[model samples]
Target: MHSTPWSSAHRLDPADQHLRDFLAPRHSPAGDGVELDVDTLLSQKYNGVVELRVQVAAFSFQNSPSSQNAPRLLLDSSTPLNGVLEALSGDATYAGCGRCSAELSTDANGIYSPCYPCLPLTGVRRYYRPGVLTVSGRGYSQLCVLAPPVPLQKILKAPPDKLHRSSAPGSQVKLIQVAAERLHALLSLPKKTFVITIRSHFLCDENSAPLSQDFTLLDLQLPTDCK
Candidate 1:
């Protein structure tokens, strides 16, 4: 006896078990589902709103600044803790490898091993969080999800205090050291395997990106939080 492939999705978000069951056939390549995908909706009306139920696979807090090439800080367990706080405490932008950015760990004789390559991979940036997800019934995976400050704060379960970095880690950092704290909170939350309704948009030239759907999350709830 073998468990079904769709069963995993049901277990991932039991609250959406019915939804998965209803949309499973349409989701699969077999194509029994009369799903209204982004293209269908867009064709019907440009910049159309397509309702979708998706699983939030990863949570990334991006430090996307006005600089077209600002390094994005993908806050995860691997992100250096002290380095995060230090950068938030001072600089508006930090550019350095993880080894140099993190607090030094020295042996009894003051000797320490260096992180080879010394790559500037892990960064502490200032700005947006894309809780990217994949739809349950649908045309693509990894939907480019966006959200307004209020909805984001609710989903991330962040405090409404001035500490929350809804968008930019503004110049107000000198008085409010909230960026690091907020990052800490987001990293601590249950950021995986959830569902939400999304609004679809298109590029100004009158088309949506072919590879990824432009989405604005209407709302989201983590599986654990629902329990």
Candidate 2:
């Protein structure tokens, strides 16, 4: 195994911190000869998104004559976009304000109402409405969540411009759901390396005379213990 060091900084909400803590070395069994350590160099929220950089280090306690140090891998992992959206959906504080319909703010912990004096002190009800979810990573193509769960057949037949301009709520949710499920399936497999590409096409102009496509390649290296 090879060793690669990675580092980054970003703000994490309570939820993100909880996940980080769960992945820390203290939570895992140290007696198994394998140890995991996750380090967050920095975390902060900017432009309504929580951005952070992290380093995940794996250590081996088993003695080996051939190599003294356990193999290390630096991976570029993004918080699952679908997971974030689902989390927001379940939290009441992040829902749009009842009076203004303004979207609520979110952090590591969950959602919160905007700092406005006119906001009611009570009646902050929880809602199950789905909002727009967008996915973007270093090598992955960006995807926006759709409302109303548009049918795949209809999506194919509709012009790319229509899809982009569609205001229907929950239009892109189905696509994200499928993508997230597929990724989950890939991660569950016993594989050392996983590689896949996600592709999306869009109309180049309003006239629908030509089309352009975006491609994102996902290359991941599973931890030694995972295999």
Candidate 3:
């Protein structure tokens, strides 16, 4: 028989009341929508490789109320990895209160010039102003373990004009449950690359519809020797 995705131990209890409570009412967040396919998401536990795609030019937390720049990057490779690296060589304004740095590596690209160490989760937390992400990383390399269920206050405070009209009524109720369910799914996997997509929006004009933007969860794969 075909083995279950990941493993039986990693399987989520579909009947759990807590899960039911979280998944029962679900709705998409307002922003440049994010799509993830569970089957298409490869886990290194059995596959022995990890691949990721991030929108580099289109991903980053919104900096100003009217700023429309979105930076996103996508990285994918079948090679076993000891670390996750990014080309900080691209054009972008870099600013953060936390300590950060970069390096150059020699590859076919000729010294693959400038690689920026991932920012610390704490810095990311402060930069975002709100929202919590578990911290796991050494120096500049960090792993995003879990993002607790989205809070009700967050949903309510999200620029009202930018929220999905259909989701505004029940966004909080939907997010709390959805966050919990996602937490369960995350806890089930140990050695893997997971992506958490977050969408942020702001009201541009009184009559203008809410504008949503997206930021990707970069490589959350921690340095591991496990299979």
TM-scores of all predicted structures: 0.39, 0.17, 0.18
Better of 1 and 3 by lDDT: 1
Best by TM-score: 1
Local accuracy of candidate 2 as per-residue lDDT tens digits, 124-183: 332222222233333333333221112211212232223224335666544334333333
For residues 109-207, write the lDDT of model 1, one tens digit per residue: 865434455644443222223333233334443455666444555653433333334344555433234445444443443443444555665555436
TM-score of 2: 0.17
lDDT of 2 at 145: 23
**Which residue ranges in model 3 land beyond 4 Å of their true spot?**
1-129, 132-175, 195-227
Order the candidate numbers by TM-score, best to worst.
Answer: 1, 3, 2
Which of candidates 2 and 3 reaches a greater lDDT? 2
Q: Give lDDT per model, in order.
A: 0.45, 0.31, 0.29
Q: Tell me how candidate 2 scores on lDDT.
A: 0.31
Error of 2 at 108 (Å): 24
- In candidate 3, what residue range of length 10 has the lowest lDDT sum? 79-88
Q: How many clashing residue pairs appear in each of the predictions shown?
A: 0, 24, 18
Candidate 3 on 128-189: residue-level lDDT in tens?
Answer: 21223332222232322222112312322222122223334655543223322332232233
